[model samples]
Target chain A: MENIFRIIVCIKQVPGTTEIKINPETNTLVREGIETVINPFDTYAIEEGVRIKERMQQSGSEAEVTAITMGPAQSESILREAISLGADKAILLSDRAFAGADTWATALTLKNAVKKLEGWRLIILGKQTLDGDTGQVGPELAHMLNIPFIGYASSIEHISGQKITVKRLAEDRYETFEVRLPAAISVGKDINVPRVPSLRGKLKAKNETIPVLNIADLSMDEKDAGLSGSYTQVIKIFTPKHVYEVKMIEGSPDEQAEELFTKLKQLNIV
Target chain B: MEIKVDKTTCTGCSLCKNFCMYDAIEITGGKAIINDNCIFCGACIDACKFKSIEITGIHEKNFDFSAYSGVMIFIEQHEGTVAEVSYELLSEGRKLADALGSKLYGIMPGYELKEKISGIFNYGIDRLYIADNEIFKHNIDDIYSKILVQAINKYRPDIFLGGATSFGRTLLPKVAAIIKTGLTADCTALSIDPEKKILLQTRPTFGGNVLATIITRNARPQMATVRPHVMAKEPVQNAENRQTDNYLKYSDRIEFLEFDPLNFKTKYKLLSREKELGQSINLSDYDVIVSGGRGIGGPDNFSLIKELADSLGGVVGASRAAVDSNWISYPHQVGQTGKTVNPKVYIACGISGAIQHLAGMQTSDIIIAINRDPDAPIFKIANYGIVGDLFEIIPRLIKKIKNGKGIT
Candidate 1:
């Protein structure tokens, strides 16, 4: 009998636009009217996860793909989007306790929720969250789970019954590694191009009810779960002041260079 | 848990001894003996055969966050060369340490770095920590993280800093996970909050659209990875201006981490190490650099950029967009995911400055931007801005330079 794989993918919701505004008094993001989307990198993770399930099924094996995320209730939209992209199940871990959580606390909450799922064969996540740009959660989760982790994986080479091989990316080169089952990998943008959801998949996702888990449901210690448990906190927010004055030279293509040339000569740089 | 060697399977090839960073293993009578200095990094386990070595036992514990003080910078060095980002962090860290009235220490882990130790002291560091061992010859994240965590537990630094390079990005998060602390990545600025006596870690979020200032009020070692070239390097000076005798602190008493070996077991094995080969162009070493972005149009269009660079005796660079479009190889890329260059003069041709691109090169001595769009963010930072097409402007500039009318 073939072993059925239980794959879990983590996703997040981020502002669709780069222009994020913060309320000075609250020091929090002004999210009342902003549009949101699944983090660009998370889409790639979802595509890879769904592809893995389809590949296994074609080979006469059973596999289930579950998409999980930690955020506000509105974040369920991304979970639905994941389901529409072929995820077999969707879970949203949301709670007031999870608010103001940094990467450390966030990873712990997800780790606890994952423990309840039991028998998870593999975990997939985006290389980093676009909103925070921390790239810490996946590695932290892998450490907390005591499993081997491969980050910024560009390709999956082979997968057998209890082993897998992947091409991991570095700054200048790629290194290949083989690891046993029950591992996790964070995929990069280059891994695969995501496919659009079909009409049927979208319809199913729109009607599906996502199960929401809270801190209490995960049986987590209050001291280890949210803002109180977060090791770091934000002190303030402000624009970085420019240290040097910018001198804008106004002119035509030829004239602009001529002006720049004169300035460089005066500065003894030419 | 303890790491034990099986007598029956041990071939005594002496491979384990060669890989141990600490003198924690000795092959006597054709069997490896574990010493007290062993932090259980598991490097020997990966290099062993015959299932001779196995880790047994487990120990769970917590650290007192209030006991740690001082600011420590992880001087990320590889193959005996310290990265430039380390110096930048040192200069910035020096300010933070002074603001808090605490001592500043530098920690370096690598092999064959005896000669480089003096070079680090030139930055005016108070204390220097070096872990010179064979296992540190190449960066293996798992081993390095264990060594770092143990060092933190012993020294109790209130604040820690590292470069946001590939080595630091992978290593620090793992260490933070074990220590149960927070780590802010790719910070653009760092400072100390006087009232709270906490580290202020400011970094960009939301694809570099907004900046968030974070503080580790509860954590002992408030950690951050600052991007290279964003901060200024301390000016080099004579040895008399530096603390020359700080190296004596580690003369005979090397603090090797004393921890249980079983907790550090890892299944990952490094098959090989490939040095970054080829591409003679190192952006940071050049004094003058000319870069092209999507505005350059195509791969062949880069010739204009190269011509300008050649005329000035400088190097040609590219933005991430140009590299992603296959217009040029990644070696020419200069951005957040690419190289952070700190040249004396940086010329941007047709590159609409995205935050990601600007974060990499905003610290240049002088910036010259030539773009058609006046409102492009690149113009705001340009010391000399020209609102024009690069194709038309670059050729005229090249002609003037070649004729020795503008540049001598």
Candidate 2:
């Protein structure tokens, strides 16, 4: 176990779709039937981790990929899904004390879990979760663990001898960086196309027993686990107001085009 | 912290259940029970008319926050050219500083940025802190975060703002974690609460379906990153008027900090940086954008969108459906998962806009929708809408523009 290379992939369970609706009369979110699934971006991270392990195995080395998640009890399903995808082991960090965690607290919780893992080589996570939409957890986790961090990785060029090269996709340019081991990386969706779980893998996932860790199990203080440790607090939540009255252009295709053209000309946009 | 429903006060009303986006509440046996799914967002607490829900254990810590003063903006640049978002942040930072009755400062880390320093002062920055060294030329998360943490400790700023660019998104979180503070990402709005005199950070969450106003009550240096084009950029004073009075005054206040580059060694080594080639046009830079969707039928049909964009001197854009269908690359995608653009005119051809897609481009000045479906959602937000086949309408629009018939 000490000789085997260890890769940890951080995953999350998010709403299956982003098409959330608000009850206009109640001014509240309509959440009765919305389903949850493994975050789409995290699937890529899981795939990349599995690919790294397979690559290592092809080179005649032993490697294992472990998936970890911090969410509610239902989130264990996503962990099992990660196993079906290719992760060798899965861990669920769920507790009532861990609720209401801001990015800082969430990263801190993850850091504690990583420390408990011990002897881990690399950590991978999705660039962001769709629900949170804040890409802060990865870097914050890295800082908490006192390790190097590389983000928005589009591809892994190579991994050899305690070093890994990753291609990062920035806004204006693509940068390639060679980072030392014991580092954390947040990969973008372009990393790889995730494969579907086979029947055998799904059967194995159905029977796999995942260990759940709470704040007490991680040796973390109750105050530092959730809302109490969060540096930021949300005071208000509301839907954005849209006040636009669309003017329909009624006529033939030529007439509609002419009217739009005239309007653009009037506005000095064309 | 602990969140619980006072079952004695709860009337079994499902009002709180509707407010929960996480579906954590269940009405079992005529009582609302908070299950494990609750993230403690407090949305239900607000919805419960009877005040049946409460979150306890949020004990406030006592720290000396009075020592922190002034508002600081991180100046991001590339190849000596300052990013446009930096100026935008400065403009917004100026307002926050004024509301707090404090000075607005700019912190820049780059190599040989002396020439560009003066232009930054025009944005009402009172003092500019410079870290001009060879090691600061390229952005490595480790080195930049260290420099930022050093500056933050030395000059304590109550509020710090940054652009939500690729660099800031990757770098600021590490800095915030190292400094042990709160940093919000992709904030849409920032304002100072008149009573508390704190920075109120507002951002879209749950896939832009809801907006959350956040506050760092217990942390100093409340940090946030704003996306480009989300805020308006206005010079403190006009360029012509500021040249003599404001610029000189601001320039005299510039401070060059000394940082030993040897002390900051990055664990990661930059191998190379290559500019993305082909179809790399930033859609936000264009005043007009012509987009296509799944209705375009196939990838070959995007040539029409490109042609229309070319005729208007704009850039080609695509809806997520089009991009996901492999009609075009992901860079051209305009939606929640893609780049947000607020062009002067956004022409959507054959797109039935989803809420996610509309979140990206709904801010555009003028939106024109052309779709065969008369009830397409794009038309709801569109300033001008056309109900017809885009294939027939686009060619005519492109030909009319190309014929120089509508030009001055």
Candidate 3:
């Protein structure tokens, strides 16, 4: 075993698109039946982690990579999916006591799990989950763990010993940063394309038995977890009060152009 | 029952004293004396100096918020893994639990359930309902819907909330369909209804043109999906799981196809990626904002916008017309479907008052809009609106603010 850094990569599954249809009868999204994919952003985290691990091994450094996931009983598939991506190990944080957890709570759980992994030197996460799109957990987790948080990382620049640097993308510009090890880095969807699992990797991951943890074993109680421990409350969910149909004017190119100019003239659009 | 009173204009109006039967008020030193016993009634609000008495409604008309209820969060997981939005939802859920009385529960189904359920507990979820089954694994529409459909039927919860995630955005509709109910999507605000026993769903319509509050009148389980980042995340003071439920059984009706990993090229890619080595979408990751309006003139002048954004280490934003006119790129436009930004600072340049534009940035923490016209509708929402030419104002203002230290 060489001195490659020990890293943990976290990923999540999500709906792929924003323009989804709603079940008119149900008044909710018509997800009952559509395909769900890994959150586009989280895949970047997996890719970056795997790349780092691969490079470390190439350089003759011993780097151990693992995937961590927190989800429902059905979510183990995600860990298996992570394993197929070349992670050496995967851990699932499951328990009835961990339900209804918000961002801070979720990060707290991840932090606790990482704490148990003695040699963890880095944690990689997606810039944001497509579903909530809040992008708050990485920073909050970093703050909680007293570690540095690098957000919106577009690419990894260099990694040497306990010092690591990355190029963070921020719309038309980039900021490079150097931080200590064991830090959390949130990457965007464009970071890299996650490759399909190889047959060998798949076979190994399929045989690997992932472990699960609960509130009791985590030394946490249900009283403060889930809804109780969260600081903000969602009092209600309702449709917006405003209602006005979009009336797009359509016609032949000339006619459409004429109508546009007419409306512009009428309203002095210019 | 929290109240804020302006101390300067209090004329010792005792009407508040008469209205508060809870003995939660005081009228010491010529101001309305609000005590702990005051029950947050608006009776005294109509009787104060310059009508400074504003009664904020903390509770809605559905659930009795003070009572203990299970922290029931509609899990927005992807392929069985928890989504970041789920964490945000849990953060907000935890807060709601503390405000009223409740425990957080993450509900999902699949076979061979893992410990992801417990991970959420550290985020403060008190319980998990992990129903393991094959159909629940792939987010199987019919199977997953039926499972939640069955679960809700059995659990009979007071409230069920999900994130506006893609899965949530898609699956909730189907689950609600299976249950034969209505669901609110993209809610910006949520409140508990003390009497109605319903979930109030507020979503913007006409592309954020208007905010509508919807309520499921007769549904058994009040279901709604909240937009991400709309609510503040709560910190995990401590974590503990109160209870957890295990698999009772699995249904064979649902088939799970362990999804073959996605090939990047097969999926819908963005129109184009940024050419610069270190570039990403700006609006996707910013806390403060400084936007530009038509006042700068012509799309070419947008370089001014870039300069300003660079100077402040912030993102540049534009009104609807700016994008429609092709003056700026599409990514920078802020509107209903265009983008929903809640930055700490929003600066509007030369843009006139347009409801569509206002719909997008009005919710910003602080709005500083500039226009030659003082009566521009933009000024209505602006904490600070300037009436001057952008050419004359921006450069000078930027220099002044940078040199003086504070613009406010």
Candidate lDDT (C-alpha), each: 0.76, 0.86, 0.59
Give every prediction's interface RMSD.
13.8, 1.8, 18.9
Candidate 2 Cα deviation (angstroms), residue B165:
0.8
**Model 1 spans with C-alpha error above 4 angstroms:** A18-33, A54-61, A242-245, A262-270, B1-66, B235-265, B276-289, B309-345, B353-365, B402-408
- Candidate no. 2 TM-score: 0.95
Error of 2 at B38 (Å): 0.5
Candidate 1 chain A lowest-lDDT run of ten = A22-31
Native A-B contacts reproduced, model 3: 0.04
The candidate that wins on DockQ is 2
State the lDDT of candidate 2 residue by residue for B104-209, as single tens digits.
9999999877667677767887888988899989988888888888888999999988899888997999888888899899998999999999999998887777
What is the C-alpha interface RMSD of model 2? Answer: 1.8
Give the top-scoring candidate (TM-score).
2
lDDT winner, 1 or 3: 1
Predicted candidate 2 versus true structure: per-residue lDDT over A1-270, tens digit per residue: 467889999999887555465454544566547689888789989999999999989988789999999999999999999999989999999998888899999999999899998678889999988878898999899988888888999889999648999998787689999988988999876788899997877988999999999999999987787888899998887776756678999899899888887887787866
How close is chain B to the truth by TM-score, in each candidate? 0.72, 0.92, 0.63
Local accuracy of candidate 3 as per-residue lDDT tens digits, B350-396:
78846556667767766666677766767666765556666655565
TM-score of each: 0.79, 0.95, 0.46
* Model 3 alpha-carbon drift over 4 Å, by segment: A1-4, A15-20, A23-28, A32-36, A239-242, A248-251, A264-269, B1-408
Candidate with better DockQ, 1 vs 2: 2
For model 2, fnat equals 0.81
Clashing pairs in 2: none
Count of backbone clashes, every candidate in sequence: 2, 0, 101
